[model samples]
Target: MKHDIVIVGGGVPGLTLALALAQSTSLSVAVLEARDCVRLFKRDARVSAITQASKRIFKKLGVWSAIHAQAIQSFTRIECWDEAGNEIDFHCETLAMSALGYIVENQAIQFVLQEALQSYCTAQIFYSTKLIALHEKEDAIMLSTDTGQVFHAKLVVAADGAMSFVRERAQIILDKKDYNEEAIVATITTTAMHEQIARQCFLKTGPVALLPLSDSYRTSLVWTLPTAEAKQYMDLKPDDFCKALTCVFSKRFSEVVVVEGRQSFRLCKQQAQQCVKPRIALLGDALHTVHPLAGQGMNMGLLDAAALFEIIHTAIAHHRDFGSHAVLRRYARWRKADNFPMSVGIDWIKQLFAANTPVISLVRVSGLQILNRFPTIKNYFARYAVGERNGLPKLAQ
Candidate 1:
């Protein structure tokens, strides 16, 4: 089989890219996914905080409307505080925006993207198929699947995951840091309504985020803790876990009840030394992974898809080889510049907050208070968080 572009994952980023290419250009795109379609649709329980930039990209792809019609929670304000009583608030009104971002379940986004992809005749999804080998050619790339099938493409995308087989085969080095921390994710119902506000509280161990969901009384929880402590929390019965969560959260929500099963994942900050090699470009988790402190992981990946699409579109307009190293390097450079700082910054923030020493705690408290006093700085951060920035792709703009 032959295709203009072969994307080696069926996740949100990969599907988004395929749909964008099929909608905007004549490229024949194929997506190779290792899981069944049903499994892919129901895999992720976590919700993603979609930034304004990502929403715009989805709009351009004609899927945002469907996603909006589905269950999505929009939060206009984000309130963050520490155990020391220092608090910082970010409001969308201050920035003249309707909402900072929308919280959508990961599966919902995937379902919408997959459904949209079906309308494009140029895009094909191959589930239960995995890439087993890749070979770079002068004019094309050859890929072999676990099913003993062979395919060729002018370009291949490594959107598999953080542990990407394509990236490994390409010999891309990764700089990784294990924070030795784990994040506990669950859905909880609180006695108090969320009021369309996202709340996060920093504890001595780590930060806890209460993301507003569609239900006023339900919120998604992402609590970071040491690995061992996370295990203890995960092992607790539902009622006991809710009690502990209420206490740790300082009873701000009155009372909390775990409404869904809890899940935990290790927290790590990792970035590929390079995001491209010849005809192969990395996207999403294949390129970088950051701490979930700010919920920017999916946002970053979506922007990556947008940026790569723009670069390829421009290359096609100019009659340049979209898969050429020169063209792919533009994407690599663009995303690295944007992703590197975020990865480092989130890691720094995690480390800074994890330290509960007297001096560090005082510094944290003072920093939040001082930053809160300056609307200019806060607005700048809020803008960045909502994906308002210079050099954005045409789709996102």
Candidate 2:
């Protein structure tokens, strides 16, 4: 089989890119997914905070309405504080937007994108198919799958995730940092209503975030802790876990009555040394991974997809090879400029908060207090958070 583009991994990024191209361009696209379509719809306890820019991208693809109909929790305010009693608050009113962002289940986004692709997309998706080897030729790249299928494409995209087979096969070096921490994720019903607000508390150990859900009393929790400490928390009974969590959260939510889908994963930051090579391009977690303290990972991946789509669309309009190094390099430079600084900023914030010394705490608290007092500066950060930065792709606008 041959196509103009082949995307490895049918996750949100790959599927979004495939759908975008299929809807707006004439490229013959294909997606290689290692799991069956039914498996993709299984309940994913994880949720993502979709930025305004990402929402617009989905809207352009004509699937945002379907996704919104399924499930969505819109939050207009964000409150973050430290143990020192210093807090910073952000409101959507600062940007004249109705909502700062929407929190949606990861599975919901994936299901909607997959359904849209299957129903009307010209692109083809192959389930139970995995890329085993890829070789780049002068005019096209050859991909071999575990199912003994061979595919040729003018361009190949690696959205397979952090442990990307395509990235490894391409020999892209990754700069990595292990924070020696694990993030405990769960869905909990609290005694107090979240009031459509997203909240985060910085503890001596790490940060814990409560993201508002559709239900007034339900929120998603992401608590970062040292690896060993995380295991101890995971081993506790649900009641005991809730008690400990409530204490650490300063009882802001009153009490965590029901905790479901409790799980933890190690935390790390990784960046590929190069995002593109000849006919191959990397996006999403394959290109970079950041601390989730800000809930920007999914949004970042969405932007990457949108940006790449715009670049390729322009190339095709000019009758240039979209897979050429010249065209791919443009994408690499564009994303690196936007993604690199954000990655570093998130990592820095994580490290700054992780330190609990009196002086360090004082400095951070003072910084938060100062920033909170200045609405203009706070609004600047708020704008960046909602993906209102300049140079956004047409889809995001």
Q: Indicate which candidate wins on lDDT.
A: 2
C-alpha lDDT (0 to 100) for residue 394 of candidate 2: 92
Q: What is the TM-score of each candidate against the true structure?
A: 0.97, 0.97
lDDT (tens digit, per residue) of candidate 2 on 1-397: 9999999999899999999999989889999988888544555569999999999999999999999987799999998888777788888887799999999999899899988987655699898897788898989999998778999999999999999998998999999999899999999988889999999998888999999999899999999999999999999999999889888765465788889999899989999999999899999999888999999999889989999999999999999999999999999999988998788788878878888788877788777877878888879888987899998889999
Candidate 2 achieves a global lDDT of: 0.90
lDDT of each: 0.88, 0.90
- Over 1-397, each residue of candidate 1 has an lDDT whose tens digit, in order, gives 9999999989899999999999999999999988888434453459999999999999888899898877689999998877767788989889999999999988888889888888989999999997788898989989998879998999999889888989999889988989899999998988888999999998888999999989899889999999999999999999999999889675465589655858999988888888898899999999989999899999899889888999999999999999999999999889978887777778878877888788887787777877888889889978987899987888889
Q: Which ranges of candidate 1 are over 4 A from the true structure? A: 39-44
**Angstrom error at residue 21, model 2:** 0.4
* Model 2, residue pairs in steric clash: none
lDDT of 1: 0.88
Model 2 vs. true fold: TM: 0.97
